[model samples]
Target: MVFDRLIHPFCICSFSLTVSRTKSESGVPEVPVPADDTPEVLNKALSGLSSRWKNWWVRGILTPAMISFFFIIIYLGPMVLMMIVLCIQIKCFHEIITIGYSVYHSYHLPWFRTLSWYFLLCVNYFFYGETVTDYFFTLVQREEPLRILSKYHRFISFALYLTGFCMFVLSLVKKHYRLQFYMFGWTHVTLLIVVTQSHLIIHNLFEGMIWFIVPISCVICNDIMAYMFGFFFGRTPLIKLSPKKTWEGFIGGFFATIVFGILLSYVMSGYRFFVCPVEFNNDSNSFTVDCKPSELFQLQDYGLPPVLQSITGWTIVKLYPFQIHSIALSAFASIMGPFGGFFASGFKRAFKIKDFANTIPGHGGIMDRFDCQYLMATFVNVYIASFIRGPNPSKVIQQLLALRPDQQLHIFNSLKAHLTEKGLLPLLEEAA
Candidate 1:
């Protein structure tokens, strides 16, 4: 469907080129030059944009259909979202492979026929990560979600995932393509997991959507800031790969992401200081008899660690471990977000394209929009793991919850001790 829909526009543009070439060859005996093409190109783009601004005839016909789909997904919730995403993934992958084949001439995809394409999209309609099936079985068994999934067991997960991979491969065979077995095959799998996992992460892991919102807000705010600064103040080019990307825009975007990231994260995590603990707290205050460390982050009148801890009535003994996360998060945002953008620029240059796809009016493709957040999220997830564990032991999040209650409490105490040693307080303890 993607190829079919895209091909229409591409073919139209191709036809225009053909007519121009023929006219030049037959009538004028002149070849088209870059300079001569600008007027016609601008006219075409303007015409295209104007045509896309449809009248009420089209708008009225489409509005209800659009609302229906929106309501079905938004009102129906995550299950619907998963089904929609699964369908999109299959379509996007199919389009990607088809385009690759046409562009590269590596193989002729026999299964790229319209029917075969629709068949895979239909399969998604039947299978939505076994979510409905599992729910039905769980309802029958009267089990909670965690228990229900556990009942299926690790072997079940392996078998199901393996089967899905097989089907995925089978779908590609008709497209007359094989996935890049080592690199892209794994990357494809990772993307699927990441895209699908966000729903679960927002729902179950974090207990709310807010936990994941910081990264998105930070990336978007940085993008806005970059464009604003670049357009208005950019003077020095940041890189030859992206000459339009100015140092002014780059630095502006960097600081914006860091500041916004820390601020957004503080909103999500309830920390007053918009930085990780490693950075210095610039203010100082008095810790009175009524105040405690729990409210250390309930910052006011500019206070220091000692003053805030005493004010909050927290044992001045344990403020260090808690302070580092904010500092780390802020620093990482400044570094990681810009790196993500640079990576995107590199990818675009490799493809010899200015943007991934002209899907957005001012921006690029869906992937282009999300790429920075994808990088930042992965960075934060990894950083949270290593920072929480330190050198003595490496504890990933998967292991954190499995620890016995007593072990969990012990680890908490160790964290407190570590923070106290560092001369800062943990956010949770400060909040408490």
Candidate 2:
């Protein structure tokens, strides 16, 4: 009887505890619950939290750190900027060549690697030779060695390239001819994509740091704004090539990039260091940025549109001419620049890879960072050639000064006759 009484009380206590746990303070039935926390469940929750924290750190900290470092390099001037660009070109070429090699891993073609590098050297020789001849003509004239090289640069470049071609042909095995040809084509295409665009980037830099700075800044702004907007509000996907891209991000990035371009132009336009072209000053025996800036860097009054006038009660707005041009540049950056990245995305997807390389922590490789930049460079070069460039009197004068005394006098007499014929110059005083 005593044992039965204890059992009855224990059962009643257990029943009461279960009922109390199930009901809320107001006596409503609560949702069902698991009575025990399993180790697996706890571990999974912890793992998810850890992964989220890692992503957050990479996006917030590492990305900004890299951007800051790049800005510092930009501020160091064009020489440093050019070096950085060259380094990027090499790294991008490396990544692309590595991909091609991986795709044809079975091939053991002879001298393929050496020939690829030789082609790179030949292309650089051609492009940089052109740049030096064009921009530093006086310097080349002063140095006999460089003068000789400049005279035969094209022939030398062609000969070097031909040698590489011959090497490639000789190195091919009968069984691997098809693969060897495939790699040959691949190498040339990669050179066209990487080296040609890089040459244009150097051209843009020579135009002024503004051209280089503004366009690149716009792309960076677009990329950042797009990512931010997408993370918070993206729904509709923008393209199949890049699954994470969204329409919301695209629109957001576009608007942000326009504003960014305008602001960047305004700021850079005020600095002569950024507005003036890089030139070698014979007088100073060093590079100089002292020339009068182009009209694009000058301020112009633009009539405000009706919509903005209604809000601000202003009819005219004064801004740098390049600020106006920035609208087109930014539009292209937001709309078309992303396509460069999309193409890269497609390339990586085909290879079943996540990134070209993990050199930048969260940012992938140098090529990944510069994929959009190369496209922007090409556009900037084309835009300058079409709209901004004109006959440069300074370049003309520099070239004239580089000629021998006899040639100079001959040119002077020819110019005098032409000007006289055009009625711009008075004929010499009659008969001393």
Q: Provide the clashing-pair count of each candidate structure.
A: 32, 0
Please write out the lDDT profile of model 1 over residues 236-306, one tens digit for every residue: 99877667778898788777767676555455445322221211112332111121224323343433477
Q: lDDT per residue, candidate 2, 1-432, as tens digits?
A: 645644686554433434234434322223232132223544454455665454555656667887798789987889899888888898899888877665554445677777887899899989999988888888988899998998888999999999888888788786566567878998999999999999999999998888998899899999999998887889999999998899999999999999989888899898899989989888889887767877778888899999999999999999999898899999999999999999999877766666777676556777888899899999999999898898767569767876899999999999998988987676454423
Clashing pairs in model 2? none
Please identify model 2 stretches exceeding 4 Å from their true place: 1-53, 392-411, 417-432
Error of 2 at 415 (Å): 2.8
What overall lDDT goes with each candidate model? Answer: 0.47, 0.82
Candidate 1 wrongly placed segments (more than 4 Å) = 1-106, 110-141, 144-149, 164-208, 265-327, 387-432
Task: Please give the RMSD to the true structure for each candidate, in Å.
Answer: 14.5, 17.7
The Cα error of candidate 1 at residue 316, in Å, is: 14
Candidate 2 lDDT score at position 212: 91
